[model samples]
Target: MLNALDNLTRLISFDSVSKNSNEPISDYVSSLLEELNFEVERTTYMDARGVLKCNLLACRRPLSSHPKLDETQSSSASDEETSPKNAPGGLAYFCHTDTVTADRWTGPGGDPFSAIVLDGRVYGRGACDMKGSLVAFLDAARKTPHEEQKLPLWIACTADEEVGFEGARFLTENSNAYTELVAADPVSIIGEPTMLHVIHAHKGICGMQIRSQGHAAHSSTDMGVNANVAMVPMLQTLLEIHNRCLTDEALRNDAFDPPTLTWNFGVSDGMKTVNIVPDHSNAWASMRTMPGVDGKDIIEQVKRRADELGLTFTLYSGGDPMHTDAEAPFIREFCELASTYIGPNSPEAVCYATDACAFGQLQHRVVCGPGSISQAHTTDEFIEIEQLETGIRFYEDTIRRWCC
Candidate 1:
């Protein structure tokens, strides 16, 4: 309710990059949610760097006192609507407060955190990737009066989604509010940059690395061992996997662009000069995991290859794909709502994963919000004013349909 545009501007200034502690921005968001009469739930955890990060789940119920859950009840929608007023069933929205680094900011002002509105677009570090969507949903939820909310409304803000969905995973496993949200069987939306289209499925991500260590010595010395030599076999195995994925129809999902599990790799050695034998070498590989592909098998194969060569293999991440029935009744209804604004359409699929990856416990969920995905994490990220306004109406309609 406190000026939404001003909130967007303020959020952009926080510099809540994935590496930095998001406590400052979380504090401001918690205060705003509290002001909106939501009972704010907080979860805090230290990152690998030991910096404290926070996740928030704010619940706002109807004006009718507090709603307590009934153990004997199932989370069926028809039963829930008539079961109890101010019950823990309705709508929920999710957004991550962190953004990718802006080290390469090339906007007009050359400062990523200094939000600027130019030519009807708001530009900043997270203007489109997510801060804009977060503000949009918060504003819409606040617009709905407490009296209209027959069921509870939930707004969740997470940390470290861009890095590895750590905050979301932590919240789902640790937060009491998250348990209630999942139990309520509420329809949830992950407000990633989706150009306002309803998304029912998305690809997952996987990362792996192989490292080899050797003693460093001058290139002219005969006693030196090059770690890169040990990595040669692992690199070949990676190429084989990548080539197979490129043409493997069994691993493809036509719903996504390019359809196949895309692969990329990077090899690095610490040696600054080629004249020295590298003491250590590492080869990192990542791939997009589609629904049908067995990502775990691919990881195991790479690990075995590394082990056969006496190299250290690390599984940076397993695939965490999110998929819901595209033909489900709730999904159909949500798509209808989206069509009212964007004109006739069906639910979509995205190649990129979202915080939804960690929220698999929730039954009914979708990914949809304002802004095009192309602008996310770019040097000059911006969200058009039109898209932001449209996003508010879409989210408000979502809230009214379930909560009111």
Candidate 2:
């Protein structure tokens, strides 16, 4: 079991930054899963610069080959009938292997590729944000009892989650075997650093870049519409839309803090020099909305505002909101099983986005995993050793209950 943590430490030691190469980490994970008798599939993306990013999916079927039972036999059949080959359903576990740039952190402990441990914490980039959760899932799968009744387990470790969920999107579109999905990101569980929570819902994300066009001219004459000046109204309109979202009851989720849609204008760029009126200006913004809110409506509202100002703009990416029933059978069962290992009150909602949206579109019941969201993307990111062990136990117990 501890060897899994060591594997995680080694995974973090490789710098799989979002923009840089992830092949090393991907290859390492692929080899590990293969050694465990999992059938592995690899996917790679080539950037414009020809740098290759990679993702790995590993699947394992139980050792038994049981015949499908007739309707009359269903009630009396053993759990082995649900094994991947004979069962009508399957489950998938997903995690992103990429981390944000190490440059964001400072001090001697900040290097993302260097694994350090102090005070019982394994410090490194990607340690807490996701690699921790990823490793926990792997360990759980590895340690799960090989019973005849267990369903098949699929583990997907992908790239580009930090920059975007490209890897997850690709896997979902390409794979057709899974019936349920779990995203092992850190944000799902938030309680006392113990593995006691399951997240059933999360906000959806849409990122947009709005560019305003203007004619360049000298500042002294003001002959041309300054692109920067044009952006002011755009920003104000966005703020109004953001404020309006706060008042929308449909966007609110009682499970989340603040329980409303969130929008942010994160970056703006226009003129290169102060003395000149810029010909073009652009601003990047993102919206995080609850399950029922239409991200397209909010985006159109912004576009309408931009059109009213006669500003030319383009949208980059848009993501839809996702949610699963809190009372879903699988959710309830997983929550109950998690409680057996980590105690009760093991459910919550998150404001961040995950591949859950994609899986939800396919009608899969999605849930968040156990880890600390706060530790993600921070310097010296780490997951408690105890949490990993607890997660392994929970997975093992859940598989045993469902399969046997």
Candidate 3:
């Protein structure tokens, strides 16, 4: 059987960047799932740039569909005990197939896609955040035969996660596996780089842009409407709001580190020369939304300020904050497993968002996996070899605990 490292090496070779089509990587994953006798659902969509992207949802035992019982699976357990009705839930693992841009890769090698093993680590883009985590789940799925699954074992690889989770949003409506996974209400995992630590909740993602338009003219003519000048009021308003987010206790929660919305925005102008007046300027901002906080309230405040300044305010995207009660049964049980395998551990809250935000229907979802968030998207991204083995074992144990 191929180990996680073996599989990750091949997977890292693919440049599944956010701006490019993920068909190639998705195809390879689809092939692997098929070879494992998994029932696969492939969903495709055209990105904003009209590039084709793909999402894959594969199950070892697809809900009420099971075939060809492995003798080993049956020998250890009775058929009655193996009935789907007896099994309360299965496991669902979520990962993104797309990675961030690797144009700045400056590791030992020039090729970011060419994965290398050095100093007991695997180096490459997405190695930790998280093709490595994905491969670990794949290894576990490979070991867990379909015939042995008393419940479903789901694996979802979404596209465009680096670019606002577009594929996850797409599959939330289009994929049958997503439909079934939601209906199953199984405990789901968003396999980001958590260093194998469980994450109970994470902040959501939201952004808006305020644009000011004006006519360009020579500076000497004084006939041009400088968009930058018109944006002054909005800039002041944003600064005020930004400070509130940073310091206002009422606008924050203690459950998350930094607790605040962590809102940030930047101003940009298209002006080229000092002699010419700028015709266009815009301010784009994003906030990491938290639960119990009305992020929209802040957004509306910004919008109203733009209206007062006679500027256009556009809310471009919003992914709801992912939260599951840390006291939930599934979480407690998972913690117990963590204690046994990875030592004493508690569910943590991360500042970053994951695909879980889009598939918010799965209330029991948690974000956890190998590698560290610090290593994610770094110029020399890598995962320690130790994490790969431990991640595989943890996933295998989780699969057996829930499915077998």
Q: Which candidate leads the pack in lDDT?
A: 1
Residues 265-356, model 3: lDDT tens digits: 99999666898889989998899988888577888898998888889999976689988888766787788887766789998898899888
Candidate 3, run of 10 with poorest lDDT? 71-80
Tens-digit per-residue lDDT, 182-277, candidate 2? 321111221112244777777778877778778877878959777777789888888887787778676666777768777777445545677777
lDDT of 3 at 33: 87
lDDT of 2 at 353: 73
Among these predicted structures, which one has the highest TM-score? Answer: 1
Model 2 residue 322 lDDT?
63
Local error of candidate 1 at residue 125 (angstroms): 0.6
Q: Relative to the unseen true structure, what is the C-alpha lDDT of residue 181 in candidate 3, on a scale of 0 to 100?
A: 72
Q: Residues 115-191, candidate 1, lDDT per residue (tens digit)?
A: 99999999999999899999999889878887887777889999999998999989988999888888786788999
* TM-score pick, better of 1 and 2: 1
TM-score of each: 0.95, 0.84, 0.93
